[model samples]
Target: MKEEMINIQDPILQLKDVSISYSPGKNAVKNIYADIAKNKITAIMGPSGCGKSTLLRAINRMHELYPDIKIMGEILLDGKNILKMNPMEVRRMAGMVFQRPNPFPTMSIFDNVIAGYKLNGISLSKSEKEEIVERCLTNVGLWNEVKDSLYKKGTFLSGGQQQRLCIARALALKPDVLLMDEPTSALDPIATNRIEELLLDLKQEFTIVIVTHNMSQAARISDYSMFMYLGELVEYDTTQTMFTNPKDKRTNEYLSGQFG
Candidate 1:
């Protein structure tokens, strides 16, 4: 298993000339091309409605949520096209955490984290599931806060804690890739810093692709950055390079606030 993992490709995910359209004539993403680095943070930054969220959703096949939307082009994970896999299997392979802290309002904190396993039909012994809950919560730095109140409703927690619970839920699936769409956008500065710190630690175990409108967050957390404009990727480079000296004028303009 170690040998096979080592021999694998550098990109955990590859988007080859992909284009996405919601309807017959409405193209949300056009001629998009990019790769997500393995075990590192790849930041996707662009103006709102420039297909930023749409492009991130495509990685885990979340575009399938919209029946009217259609995707063309290959999205490869470990050199295999994701389109060939079942939507459920693909989602399990790449877990997603949304922009909001959306822990189930009715479920307990313990139930929320391991909900993925129960919902996905993956079986584990009672103690094993308990362990998964503890481990995942600890991994996301929420264990200490909620350890004693694991049985309490998820929504009873603060907004930041709810978001972290959602993260723990995704992590429970043991996904190879974790996609975060503006995970910190709604949180306070302290909460945002904690999430950023956790993300830096998470990439040690799994690939991370993040979409953030915050340029400072992107510069601080990402190993690499890809800039998209008008539904096209304009620059893909090391985070340092992209933030310091971008190759594309559009990227530079966007970064400098000349235009979005």
Candidate 2:
């Protein structure tokens, strides 16, 4: 089934003249202004070195973790500037998944799902933790596969299963937006397809912004698409329009067989 089209005005996250630099005098992301809609999937696609991952990190303030990195302009979540919010709070509001699945190797599958709350010093009863685990794992389609093995180490799962578990971990926090960087790139085709299906289902509850180099994957899952080149957002439109009738020549060239 086709996802409902989100009105452009309904933004959950907004970037206003946002720019990021790893060092003085060199910007990795430049003057980006885009609005991501609620309960929709947005794909950020560009060639290598195009600042896709850099911009994704900025949304949740991951850029602040590194020394010598600087960010300018506003990133708003529900009309509030995230730059002014506590980093931990920003991260809790917007969860992230990396290219590689990195569940805590020593932790059990069940423990990994509720690790966020534990690490953040948020207390919950055993029943509450169990409820969170089951709810999140079920949402990510991992509960059925790993229910009996909840006490086993997380690293024992396959790459796809581990990735799904990581997603469950993120979902346990009840985040409003999910930021994924090349989420399915490390998985096999079957696993990638499963993750894609999971993402489609997830958008009904969470706004998702995923960075993917795979054009076919972006076309398959994203409701809206953003094309970036040389640190600039070249075009943004509904996926249907961006793929079929992009307004920018650069977007057309990138969508075509020309330069990425």
Candidate 3:
């Protein structure tokens, strides 16, 4: 394991009594409230469809892409309601990485990384853009592999490389928060380990919230953990306590693999 690099002092984003539904009648994430430790990783774990990803998607306002989804309650990012902000604006502040690696297949690697700045209507000079891409790639632990062939098609890269490229794309925007949904579930153990290392390095500069089914991965990398069950937050606690001595019996049972 790597030595600590994150400054986990205060809460960066806090969800205040939040409830989200796919439609007016169907609940996906319900009364789920949590405080994300600043400059640290907070992993959300639960059974499938238990609102783990739903809660994370809500944080970045991705659910709004679906017309039927309606989010209620306050999501305070630095103490502001994220739902009230513009959808694009919210996403910019909190970048997302989905389950599958989703680099633009047709775009060149360099162009794929610069996609955020180009699409966001933000302008940067050639030198500045190059520097941004290089720095972000380095941050995501991919610079050494792609620094020379950056102009080649992004899809030419391996699956792990593609995932890290997507991470670099997110980092290029220099977002304050990074939300990941099953980021390593698709990769081999070796690739997954690399991503976990990259994430450990990343939290020194960004807040990270991950939805993961791998309890061992969550225990290995996260500073804090939140347990969800049936669309509700059952408990939130430090990783050490959550794994070693959870106060809630439900958390204990779930972590022990009795029932998830």
Candidate 4:
């Protein structure tokens, strides 16, 4: 299928002929080329096992956790190829939030927000740590609610609060891009709405790339939309255009509930 293209003047992330394979001769993500605009929310939508999560994980080098996974082509972040950069640095620059809220069970809310810094062995003065914790928590709209309970374990918060805390942790690193893999799929409707609102607010400062199964959520929150099928990017356009006038048969079918 011919993919629709859009011009981005100064994209923060560029995927050039990117492909991933879990095993030899079996590509899971096939030759995707996209230039993701900065400070915008781009939603990747598709059915199960269509490589949306695989592509999102590659942005932060999460696939490295499995040595068998192989990735090819250049994933550029801020004009530098992230595939060539150190995984630690790449991850720090492209922070991720998973499908579910996963705060460290043993750590306090404050500690969870700064977990990335500690895990990376980056030291900061007590004052600096306090500042970062407060700033990040405030950013995710958790500070006022959790300030009195900062020392409580992060897992103690409600599911939505925990997810927000996870988002705060990602923000603590001040990443250039925020990669979310179905961030709201595990939350209640109320919680999901909060996250959607937070994401909109967040795009003002950080670029967002999200993989979502919920087309409504994608339409509601994303500025741009990408539809993938069978490991291939089938269409990409502004959210307004793609949802109302999708170019590909697959995209239209998926949007119309004819198929996933």
Candidate 5:
């Protein structure tokens, strides 16, 4: 049977000839063009140094924080050029979670969740802050476990809990897109499973773009998959199709363990 094609109208974000370079004459990500569907989980997969994470960071302009990095082409979020928007606003709309759980050590559990607002100088009333804390924590499945100790330091929680706290922090902004860079790579099996479950549920509300090295994790959670190699995107298709029958030789080899 022939596979159904992805419709152009379904995309929430589109990358057009996107490329990134960390230094002169060296492109980390080269000429990537793809559409990310709304409210679906999209995984970017490749071996280390293949530019999966670089492309993920460029989605929200995270590379701008560094002086040496430069990006080319347009990354449109809902048809608006994200690079032209204010960096902070862009980040708020497309929040990120890193490889490690990086809850602020100096802040309490409650503060960590609302840190984005505070850092941005957005003042909230006591009641408003409380509402956000509860809502975001609950969103990440951490409210029940941490509610009693909301005032404790963020570092007080276990590794999994800290990761959840970081996720809660991002969710508090109510982002349109959530970008995760190997979010569960540092986690243990149980913790990773929990995060995977959380991501599955999250796709119902937000468009999720994740960079993952774990092939099985991508196969299990992503609705669409992009396979990159040596700074180039080799294939982008439905996860089932990409895994079962990739059109590109590189993608097939990578999936078959012949090369990465």
Candidate 6:
């Protein structure tokens, strides 16, 4: 079925006829076309192996890490086609946070936040690094908690704090969009609530595309929502509309707890 469309006056990102395949003639994500509005929280929800993560990873060309995977599409970020851009540059513009908190085990809290600049071979002076570290940590609401322990290893922090630190690391690059894959899944309820609140604040500054399995989370935080099933986009609409009056039978079923 064709995905529902909503007119976005000036979308920050556009996915045009996107498809991904792990093997020949077998696509994990079928052609998907959508316009992502600026500074809004958009959620992608679907059952396992439905290509939510595959589609998200393709936004920043993460699929390039595997030799056999193939992606065909035009992913435009701020009017530039990211598919043809340098992978490193694409990643910097659209920073990603994974399902679990993955702070570099070897790096300290301060160093982890600026890891992107170091990895990109971009040099920063002592003061510049300090400024970025503080700003990013403050953005993720982790500054005061770990301020005194800036030199401590990131892995020493709690799961939720580590995830926030990971977010701070991603934000340090000053990305245009933030891509999250089940970011709060590994944390406790309190921690999850904190991350949700953080995301709400973040949408004011950055466009967010999150792949989540939790429908409640989507309803609570997303401005727009996409429901994908079996590699195809089943529906896309405002969270309120989609929840109360979905256009597709599959979407209604999924939302009704009839199926995952």
Candidate 6 lDDT by residue in tens digits, 1-260? 35428877799999989999999999999999899999999999999899999999999999898999999878899999998999989999999999999999999999999999998899999999999999999989999999999999999999999999999999999999999999999999999999999999999999999999999999999999999999999898999999999999999999999998
The runs of at least 3 residues in candidate 2 whose Cα sits more than 4 Å from the true structure, single-residue gaps closed, are: 1-7
lDDT of each candidate versus the true structure = 0.87, 0.93, 0.88, 0.96, 0.91, 0.95
CA RMSD (A), model 5? 2.9
Q: Which of the two, 2 or 3, has more TM-score?
A: 2
- What TM-score, over all chains together, does every model reach? 0.95, 0.96, 0.95, 0.98, 0.96, 0.98
In terms of TM-score, which candidate is stronger, 2 or 4?
A: 4
Candidate 6 stretches with Cα past 4 Å from truth are: 1-4
Instruction: Tell me the lDDT of model 5 at 97.
Output: 97
| Candidate 5 minimal-lDDT segment of 10 residues | 1-10
What are the per-residue Cα lDDT tens digits for candidate 5 across 154-251?
99998989998999999999999999999998899999999999999888889999999899999999999999999988888999999999999999
**What does candidate 3 score on TM?**
0.95
| Candidate 5 or 4, higher lDDT | 4
Q: Give the winner by lDDT.
A: 4
Better of 1 and 2 by lDDT: 2
| Candidate 1: pairs in clash | none
Residue 68 displacement in candidate 2 (angstroms): 0.8
Residue-level lDDT for 222 in candidate 1:
96
Candidate 6, TM-score vs. the true structure?
0.98
Q: What lDDT score goes with residue 13 in model 2?
A: 95
Clashes of each: 0, 0, 0, 0, 0, 0
Local error of candidate 2 at 13, Å?
0.1
For each candidate in turn, give its C-alpha RMSD to the true structure in angstroms: 4.5, 3.9, 4.7, 1.3, 2.9, 1.2
